[model samples]
Target: MKNVDIDLNLLVALDVLLAEGSVTAAAQRLGLSISAMSRTLARLRAATGDPLLVRAGRGMVPTPRAEELREHVHILTRDAQAVLRPQMNKLDVDALDLTFTIRVSEAFMAFLSAVVVAAVSKTAPGVCLRFAPKPDKDAGPLRDGVIDLEIGVIGTTAPEIRTRFLFNDRLVGLVRTGHWLLAAGDVIRPETYAACYHIAVSKDGNTVGPIDAALHALGLERLIKVVVPGFPDAMRIARQSDLVALVPQSCVGNHQTPDHDAMSGLASFDLPVVIPDFKISAMWHPRRDADPAHKWLRDTVMDICRAAYLQR
Candidate 1:
């Protein structure tokens, strides 16, 4: 690449020409006269030092260089359009046609999916939502635009990402109904709870976590019988066996049929140990902070979560 003084407007003309493959068609697409499009193509060729298009039997064909620049040119055009568009007072929710990728924990999805879906459907009918598995709290995906929103505990979020707390979540204990522990207790005591075999849920496969730390405070420890990567998986195991699962309270909803049947053999109780309630928040890149549609989405999601919490 050499230092060349080229007007950015020529890049759009080149993009249109390569896409249409004919000056007349490009001109029609661009709202320009055929002669004007021809002149623009001439300027583009000079700027790139290549006859970017060559004449075929009846139409034009992009040369190798023009083919190479096609995708880049299209991306540049889109970015330029985004920058030049006038800001709107409110998002046109019903007309939104954007795709948003959200990174979230499986626990959040287990509880919040229906609320999120209903809220978004009522507002942005054309918007598509992609949920990416969140293996950790690293902010790389959010910063790089791979993830539009992150829903999880607020602790590890990057300083630059904007976050709004959706709700506070506390740890609770779960077991199969008619379990021995529930039969023996009015209130779960740390000693008996720690004596039970535990089914742990850890994203990274670490069996020990804040739950263990809370137990350690009372000089007790639960023997982890199994370790899984998500809350739903742990609950599944607990529902089938004698193992106890400590999970977020908000996550245990009306059980599915099999689980509902399984529940006749299990029980749920508040954890005897004290762990600080964690804040689950929705985080997004600052670049989209002012986007009307994105702002609407963020607000809608927050409202849904808040309403769900109140109703619960």
Candidate 2:
């Protein structure tokens, strides 16, 4: 049978025609003209490779093949109707047993993971959030369904990818306690900052960034002594040595958290150079936009991140 080309509308028509056993009756039921119904029946027969209906005296009767298909076709048509029906897809959070993978930067993940897990555990106990390091801003994972969400500064991505602003993040300087730059005070002058050796954070290991450009604009530059793949690594290196780490505010843990206490020896100061704050966003593929469970997960994360920012 050449049924590969058959569409949902054709399946629906087949169900009605098989049940009614009359072309005129089926046409009226489907709100189509008698001639249009006849044409549809012809197409269905051609596609099914069967004489689905034939005249018996003055009325029509279903063939053996049609009788066999009638029940299955009706069930399929009804299921299609239910799936395409316009209604709120209500989700039972407690019953959901799906694991969603989120691609995120190590810095943000460090601060966000515990709180996000706590929240999700309280509400949807069965759901799991797997955090994967984002090596770069590649939208391929979301497109291929390898990841359900992405959290980071949104950059060049597919135009169709959906993004929502989570919070604004600004660059901050991290230095070890009693560092020479902070010997005078918490505020370091541009020249003093420029004199210090720096640790640059780049997932792809590119050394120069916004801070470099800002410094060069004033004919001042900081020597980048080391390049790290993540902000956490930069923070660690900064804590143990005199090398300065420049990181986003989001990378700093909440003041109330033990994570923050762990960084008590490292002081965070505003950058002497002017670097504009960038928006950290939640990005996902459009295919999951209207999915109830996915929407719940997005909203949950958005709310948590917003509250976390407020606390910071």
Candidate 3:
């Protein structure tokens, strides 16, 4: 058995030597003695079995073999430097082409999809955002790398997952323009609001939530005549029928243009009973905490959410 010696430093020296075409200049460029560089060149010639450089009258010239390896050696060295260097430089969003999978609720996406898409298009035209449904807050997709981001209230997440608060959201009631609730009075009391048939929105088919508990505490309960899988469906039902749909304020949007507003043609009213405002956050795996693209995505989302919050 023969031992094979591998030295990566020789590649760097060879790249400098081929570029400068002089042992003395290569040594000066690499901060090494000329004698040391000469010995390094001898080692490179013996290793590659090629006279990489030869005398050209007053100066040195790269041999055909050296020229062949020049471009390859330069690329390898540059790639190595990029790989080892810290990514502290500014990101080139325009040139970045990437697809990011985000697990988000249909309601939030419906409210902010247009704005988010427009923002990404203006800044990172080549980046694509793939929004997936948030069936449950398991946070498994983030840990498995199946999704780059999970946007919603933090729940049942891994201990190591990173989360950034986006905004605070609370439940709001939605009804049709000529609904009897609006005709009832300026303020719909708990009993009056509860008396109306309600459309319960639950992804997991559970018809009960904090609203129910609050009503129960007051010895009043709303009639949940219909159950839907998501907020969008609830809103649709509330628009056509006389059912009341309770959804997040963010789902209806704080200040959306009429064309982009999800609450268009529908009336949004504050819930009669108090429901605690929950913090909406963007969650990601700890492994992506330092990724430049992931950071940009998070920051962009944060900015959008901040703008929405400010409008409120």
lDDT of 2 by residue, 89-193 (tens): 678888778778998867578778778899999999999888887877888778756589999889744999999998877888999988888889766789889
For candidate 3, the lDDT comes to 0.84
Question: What C-alpha lDDT do the candidate models reach, one value each?
Answer: 0.79, 0.84, 0.84
True lDDT of residue 248, candidate 1? 81
lDDT of 3 by residue, 1-312 (tens): 467696988989998898789999899767799999999999999889899999989999888898889979988986785486457578888877877888887757977777888999999999988888887888766865658998888896379889998888888899988888999777989999889999998767788889999999999998988988888899888889889999888777775433234666799888888889988888999878887878998999899888877567
TM-score head-to-head 2 vs 3, winner? 3
Model 1 clash count equals 7
- Minimum summed lDDT over a 10-residue window in model 3 is located at 255-264
Q: lDDT at 236 for candidate 2? A: 86
**Candidate 1 displacement at residue 188 in angstroms:** 1.4
Q: Give per-model TM-scores.
A: 0.71, 0.69, 0.70
Model 3, 149: alpha-carbon shift in Å?
Answer: 1.0
